[model samples]
Target: MRRSVAVRLSALLATGALAAATGMALSTSTASAATGGVTGYATQNGGTTGGAGGQTVRATTGTAIHQALCGRASSSTPIIIQVEGTINHGNTAKVSGSSCNTAAGVIELKQISNVTIVGVGNGAVFDQLGIHIRESRNIIIQNVTVRNVKKSGSPTSNGGDAIGMESGVRNVWVDHATLEASGGESEGYDGLFDMKDNTQYVTLSYSILRNSGRGGLIGSSESDTSNGYVTFHHNLYQNIDSRTPLLRGGVSHIYNNHYKNLNESGINSRAGARAKVDNNYFEDSKDVLGTFYTDAAGYWQVSGNVFDNVTWSSRSGDNNPAGPNPTSNTSVSVPYAYTLDAANCVPSVVSQTAGANKGLKVSDGSCTPQSPDPTDPGPTDPGPTDPDPTDPPTGTNLSLGAGADGSSKASGTSYGNVIDGSTSTYWSPSGSTGSVSVKWGSATKVSKINIRQASGSGTVNSYRVVNQDTGAVLASGSGTGVISFSATSLKKITFEITGASGTPRIAEFETYAS
Candidate 1:
């Protein structure tokens, strides 16, 4: 992130993190014109390597996409579908298979994983059709446009959402796409990006969501706090009423986005949702940040943000706004690292890079929009100086019954205390800093972990999550909460508390496979 140069997708093709077309050389200028690679929290949870190391197929219609999904060897098969031209209900139809669960009138990515649908050639557009994803993971959507999809009229698709994910979805990244409606809910339109039913580890970046009633929502209702660990950055939200988006539960990171013409409320985080908002630009918007509609209350950690011509209504009942002047009400610690562009330059940077077209230009990490190097730059090419960290995905806590040990334990503090499932019991280092670990009898595949410090204990300033099997550090950063890394199968994992203000008491060291 300290570097001023840009990172390109062409470079990612070389890393095998993203697969390339077999017939067509991705190094060529024709294939290298788009911004590539995933950023933000999508870089976590085993990393959303969509379609990597899989077959590459081209599709000009939605039906072909279904064909690609059904033709796969299994539901988890990795495959990339390159799309161009237009895809609509007329061309998208039901095609069921072991690898897919398809339906007519919508692009359904259900019960599938490791798939990427990217626009190619002249460009790709979905006409009045939505892309619905469920029971899936490790999917990416990029460089396309979806317009005028309706949920409740003569024609409805994906419940009127341009891109909707639910039913325990995970590790999905939607980037550089355009999602827009002609009007608001009266026009039968709905959210551009909606996630619910325990959806987690998702990112929406470098896209545009505009001209609709609701931009998006993390949960369906207050009690549906089953979804979270989502990230929104470098996108443009314009001419929308509210819910850009509405967060219900869990945590999120919102940064470096441009918000314009918000009709009513924006970022209506409620139901105890927590967001880390950083370096964003809000222009001509109303009640931009707040807990609205209900008193359940959402929280945010706001820093380095810019507000221009933004209006704030008087706080009353459900209308709790973050401005006249916004400030932090909570703290959210993520597992990833990201560089933010200056808030003042966000509008220009987003305008040139946030949509389907515009040559897939992206931030150089220094407020510069860098172009794709069709020539295929190598390792020397500017990349993420420090790849952003991700979140420990949502699932069953892995530490409840796992084995526990540490470098040392203080008197009256047993090593097993950390995994006892009760915050009242805890493990403390003999001194200010030490290490604790969770081990299993057999190899366990893990992509995320949580460190909960017992109440009234010294705060963990910095730490490293290490894979004891390979002596590799999975993640290293400051703070304690969610810590994630690439999925690694190992019998033992260590949490090294490197820096602390006082003797630390770790109440839990939880792990997850997702």
Candidate 2:
């Protein structure tokens, strides 16, 4: 949204940019793009003040974010668009009014309510657009970046969801977003964030859901159990090949999330859904939490989670998978007030505050990451660019301090990132075969080992050097040099990954004693 608060606010309101104050407060007087209000549970049921004092517009195409919601004045007047650049589907169309009910090329927040679609100056990329939200309620979608949307083959597809909320939806607060989808559902792309009918109190903070093959769902099948009270904090689910969300029934509050890889099955809380998983940091992946295919059953109340090498499959019939171990059958109460932030520092505080334009940074529950509020308006596009790879790694690394589990890392990668010798920080695997271990709580004496790779990732054609307390394989690879193996003493030492050319980033897993 770049200008137009009904005929361009008379020269930006005499040059003061713009400022409004009504129910909450919406001021874009430039302090770097303000939206500093309304916290989680969207603040809770009857509290998701959007437009704030109303009228503070600016939209860069996508039909000006539905023309700042059809020049609001009814249909719950309250506006604050502000977006910028790239909103795909060629300038987007359909902009009726009676206060809006947009169509034609998505980004349509159908049947609106108090609105606010952030992403100021130079950040807001909905390339391959998608942002539905039918029968809206108090809404606020901040920052931005909805990638590769396509619920079906393209032609500027619609419903290929990158953010979809169903009818009767209520209180929705999607902050710092970056919902993505590139391939899955047979390459037609689908679900990066979805909800079915009667969607209820929602909140998805500091987000970043990657790759994709349905990383969303909360009712949409199995008798569509009226979507639950959703809330996922400090998010980041990478390479997802499962519904990091699939709660069928109701209730969800997955805290401090940072699940990496998760190539199949994760937090699928089935039918009678219920989840309150606290302090999460699950890395690698497979069966990260229970109730898969569906036999109707879902309940969780686990706590302080951090399952680093997770992998649990073998429940047969309907395929349950709460992983090698995941307890709590049910008991969740959360009525507001939140603070948890230490599931092993949730992957470095969700890679410095999850998706969309980092300046929306948040997470001061002490694991750090809280900047942006210096009056607002930060982030003029400072994204991408990781992979400084000059390929560094030279001598006796001994896997640094040791202990760095793995089986699937990919969300912003970090199984301590291969000993931290920093090849600009690397360690990916959540796809082309997986494994990356370097443990040591005792016994550590290898006979040379160095795998330094990571200068553009993927290309470890074949590997295996385990001996993790005895499964034994000591050496057997075809890439990433120096694998001598003939002097042993181990507390744990693996590299597994049996073949790749695409999902391999390990910068250094050096363990030497020769």
Candidate 3:
């Protein structure tokens, strides 16, 4: 969504911030209830059942949350803690008990098992705070926003990660959460999400990680290669400089993710890391899948991934490009069954389904088309050369600025550049808020528009296609690519960018009538 929403949510979770309490009200009475079992890839490899068949508890402040979780009399029993409002550690004092010991700065889930921490209602946010999952098993963290947890500052926890797991952690599933950082190490910010110290069987799904120096990492150090078997799917990694994430060593299944504007690196699979990279959309990124930094090396089994305008480092020691020409030494076998959406459809599918507050829209791992096949044609005699009068004419490209002219409200490199066929040339909009429109002398029937971006940095996150003459929105959604809608006859069509993470560059605005 919009950056303003994220900013407002962060502000609402800040210290001394307004307590616009949302979600389930705090309830003292505990209810014994059994929730559903864990789903998705989490069900594989012994399965993950977080708080299944357990009591439901409610907590408001950070201290209350710690009490509800760590103060439990029986640690083996499953529990679902519904968190409401902002749980900023700054608002709560240090909580100490026989079962738990937590500092004032963060909420620690230490030596806990079979627990699910989920935000409810308008959703819960943790501002300037970190959630540390240590020595835990069968855990789930969902529907929360964690932002600006600094690493170098005082009161920092979990190495400044929005969510971090380590030391015998297993079967931890993080879903539908937004994790962000203001800046990189220079800004005292660390990874949005990180796992280390023998952590295994973890899955991060339907999450948004943006504007950070490091997205996440599988292992902590080069020699620390015991952590692995992590799955990252249906996530959005945007506007980050690098490490989208940095996998030191592990067997990671990375698929169906939208990686945009990765300035430094995307997926750094190194130190014998084996990643099954499939059906991911990488735009404007550099060295998306490769072994970087150390020459100890990594392996990637890459397939069906769309690398649009992605630049690669030279093929050298540890600087190997993934796929087309891979330097990986080994291949990984994925144990679980999962369907993959085509890489071309990743931008559209991920923009509609990824991140928190999305109502948990996940694919069912069935990409097979439901339509029936047409019957085979019988042997037939050759027909006449003349075309049938009843048949419609095959559509053609309506030349821009000839029968149609292009214009924009905001100045760009050149409005005409968008219509130019050369992908090397592009029209860079001065600001995020702008519209490029094409008007024809007469009404033309159009069905589809293909938006070609210069690189990942120039990709649009959200936009709308409007029929300018009738002021009708033909289609509206997020991400750049081919946008298809009902065939409409219009004299003027405009593509308006409503929200974007970066300054978008349109290489070609190709219109098709079919």
Worst 10 residues of 3 by lDDT: 2-11
Over the stretch 78-184, how does candidate 1's per-residue lDDT look in tens digits?
77676778998777778778888999999999888888887754579999999999999988898799999998995899898999999989999898899999988
Tell me the tens digit of each residue's lDDT in model 3 across 14-49: 111212231222222222111112344565667775
Each prediction's TM-score versus the true structure = 0.68, 0.29, 0.64
Better of 2 and 3 by lDDT: 2
Which residue pairs show collisions in model 3? 283-456, 284-456, 401-404
Residue 360, candidate 3: alpha-carbon lDDT: 46
Judge candidate 2 against the unseen true structure and give its global Cα lDDT, from 0 to 1: 0.73
For residues 339-409, write the lDDT of model 2, one tens digit per residue.
88889988998897788766556775789775433222222211111112233335567888787887788
> How far in Å is the alpha carbon of 473 misplaced in model 2?
64
In model 2, the runs with Cα more than 4 Å from the true position are: 1-55, 58-67, 71-100, 103-131, 134-140, 143-173, 176-204, 207-244, 247-255, 258-266, 269-288, 295-316, 324-361, 364-366, 373-514
Off by over 4 Å in 3: 1-41, 323-329, 365-514
| lDDT value for model 3 | 0.68
Which whole-number lDDT from 0 to 100 does residue 493 have in model 3? 79
**TM-score, model 1 to reference:** 0.68
Q: What is the C-alpha lDDT of each candidate?
A: 0.78, 0.73, 0.68
